[model samples]
Target: MLSLPRSRSLLAAAAIVATVATAGSLTYSLGLGLTPCELCWYQRILMYPLVAVLAYAYYTADTGIYRLVLPFCVGGAALAAYQSYLQVVAGGTCTFGGCAAVYIRPVTIPNQSLIAFCLIGLCTLGLAVRTRRDRT
Candidate 1:
């Protein structure tokens, strides 16, 4: 069974992932010379809220919210995975203009996006597994 501390720890990890993802987006928007594609923007939308939702769930000690939050994380992961494939495997040209045009070369792999998705998925999955283990 998962202890309260353990559940909290899982939530904390999710929160950290959310925070890092948010920071990464801001960094890309500000420091890094790259504009987000439509899919990237959608992924960001999903990621940004996770920080608040997970924190809220942890603070309230309500695991029930996972039903709501997990789907968002999953959706974000799927979108990120698709974007990564398009950027890394497909090797398509980014014609969005602005900094994106300069930064994302046709040859550049979207490993960073994939990493972000993996982090989010791993954290969320950890929480779900811990919750299930606690139940059993």
Candidate 2:
């Protein structure tokens, strides 16, 4: 079995999360014929590029890429969290589709996106910590 360095492994994990989130969103909108709301679109904007960004960072073994990626993760997380708030708390309305729409019963799309963004953020933070510790 081949084991990767912690930093590289964390980048790979983040890349995987981004890929799955991107794929799942695409599946929901394109395949399942579910229309995305405005907030969903914003979350997608933040999430879709992470697939390439994290993958390229992993390919180049650039641990410092966290500086670039973390903002996007944070933005995505904020958007997802807000959407969740709208759906669950505020009973808000979106310009595009319905923010309150829930296809997976208990778990809304924004909630799932939130999980993915948070996971990617955590992995990136872990890599940052590991890189810093290694440097000192």
The lDDT of each candidate is 0.67, 0.85
lDDT of 1 by residue, 47-91 (tens): 788888888987987666677777886787786566555544444
Candidate 2, residue 73: lDDT: 91
Tens-place lDDT per residue, model 2, 11-90, is 99999999999999899889988888888988989999999999999998888898999999999999988888777664
Q: Looking at model 2, which ten-residue stretch has the lowest summed lDDT?
A: 88-97
Candidate 1 lands at a TM-score of: 0.77
Alpha-carbon deviation at 2 in model 2, angstroms: 17
Model 2 CA deviation exceeding 4 Å by range: 1-4, 90-96
Worst 10 residues of 1 by lDDT: 95-104
C-alpha TM-scores of all predictions: 0.77, 0.90
Q: Top model by TM-score, which number? A: 2
Q: How much is the lDDT of residue 133 in candidate 1?
A: 81
- After superposition, which runs of candidate 1 have C-alpha atoms over 4 Å from their true positions? 95-110
In candidate 1, residue 38 scores what lDDT? 76
Instruction: Give the C-alpha lDDT of model 1.
Output: 0.67
